[model samples]
Target: MLDRRRVLQTLAGLFLSSFGLGGYAYAWEPAHQGVTRYRLKPARWPEGRRLRLAVITDLHVGGPHMPVARVRQIVEQTNALKPDLTLLVGDFVASRTRRSSDPAPAEWAAELARLQAPAGRFAVLGNHDWWQDERAQKELRGPTQSTVALEAVGIPVLENRAVRLQTGAGPLWIAGLGDQEAFVLRRRPRGLPYGLDDLPATLAMIRDDAPVILMAHEPDIFARVPSRVALTLSGHTHGGQVRLFGWSPIVPSRYGNRYAYGHVRENGRDLVVSAGLGTSKLPIRLGAPPEIVLIELG
Candidate 1:
């Protein structure tokens, strides 16, 4: 006779652990650097202005998944690459549980400042960077505090703004968008130009015919961006965190699977969504190991 009851109990325990401590353990896996090369026609980049943009995002520091030590490793790897520009997309810290051991915001900022690039380093806030609730602001999602800390460390925080830099490639326009999760993350009313970073306002600041590279926390925003922009980068999905058979089962984008991971080109626009280098919420990573994106933009 088969002991069906015993078999079921064993399976249940396995499932529970994978979701609990098992997931957090998997998150400690060493991060990997994923290199992707893109040639953008719309970039109209001057022959000399080809840019190498390295993107590192979703470092949920202090969370059990990515502690301060692991963050140091990520910074060391990034600097070794010697990229032209580095775009940090956001979600610098967020721990959903109270039992987590997190560091002060300044600790994270000091570690991030160690990263170096020739063109410079720029960043935009992620959903986790905002306040947790409408009232208190001292929790994991520290808005003003996070901005001040990062900027003080040399990583200029670009909030709904654009900066034109004279890269070796020529004039380059880089814009940082206000996270679309602005309303959703804070539980505020949704409307245009009020709670979110105004895309129109950000785009309007760029001059005509300049090759533009925009970075947003969420990949879904890539849909609304016009084709004139040469390349758009984002890192909010975490490659679904736990993918099976090479596909993430749960991507956060409003566009669903279309913009889930990797490079997507449509209607004369190019978007590369990095898997990112840390864990969040559940604190586990399976098929989608932590990834640092190195992109050559020419």
Candidate 2:
């Protein structure tokens, strides 16, 4: 039966190819880091003011692929870009329990402190940052350990807060919302809020009509973002952590691949979702390699 033998050979070939690909995704792609750059001129952005932003998110430190040494490399690479502002979108701690080491927050924060940005370095906590803080979760309030560690190293964690900064471009507002899925693990009583994010309050903090840049850990909030905000930066999906040909089968977001990665523009609003560095549940990466996103906005 020649036809039968051919079918068996084809199946064997498919198995071998898949096995090799799996090996590469697990061992090589997870450690290989790259920079993904985007240039945007949002409608509300100042005409003459060009801002270079270095966005680092989902560091997931202490994972096998993201040791302290790798963080140093990231800092050095970002510093080389010499961005006007450095924004940390969060997830400073490791997400997975197995095969992952836990580095003290101070250790990673110290390295992050070395990141150079002329305008200044600002941060916002992610879901993992909240999840990692057992005490904060138990209490249903924060000052998460990641927040303390980052602030200790001079990085201000903006939670439902906005700061007005005078940049070469002009006066701009950087608003950061708390992690939307912060209490995913814990059950709450009825009428008790689950997420710490407060978008309206954060926006209210902005006094003027200056263009606002919102740092939200998850891109799901992009739907509610109004035209007043120039740009919204987020990084939690990690581009589905295994994108294939621009499609992700298991995107963590409710919107699927719509906000999975890159600059997304909708309804005259803009969002940039970084693929992010470090792995989550599983330490494997395929088409979605680890990346540090650089945004040049005007």
Q: Pick the candidate with the highest TM-score.
A: 2
User: Model 2 segments beyond 4 Å from truth?
Assistant: 1-17, 97-101
Q: In model 1, state the lDDT of residue 255.
A: 71
Pairs clashing within candidate 1: 48-169, 49-169
Worst 10 residues of 2 by lDDT: 1-10
Query: Runs in model 1 with CA error above 4 Å?
Result: 1-43, 97-101, 133-143, 185-195
Return the TM-score for each candidate structure. Answer: 0.83, 0.92
Candidate 2 deviates by what RMSD? Answer: 6.3
Candidate 2 per-residue lDDT, tens place, 67-112, comes to 9999999999999998999999999889854232477889999999
Instruction: State the C-alpha lDDT per candidate.
Output: 0.73, 0.88
Q: What is the model-wide C-alpha lDDT for candidate 1?
A: 0.73
User: Candidate 2 has which clashing residue pairs, if any?
Assistant: none
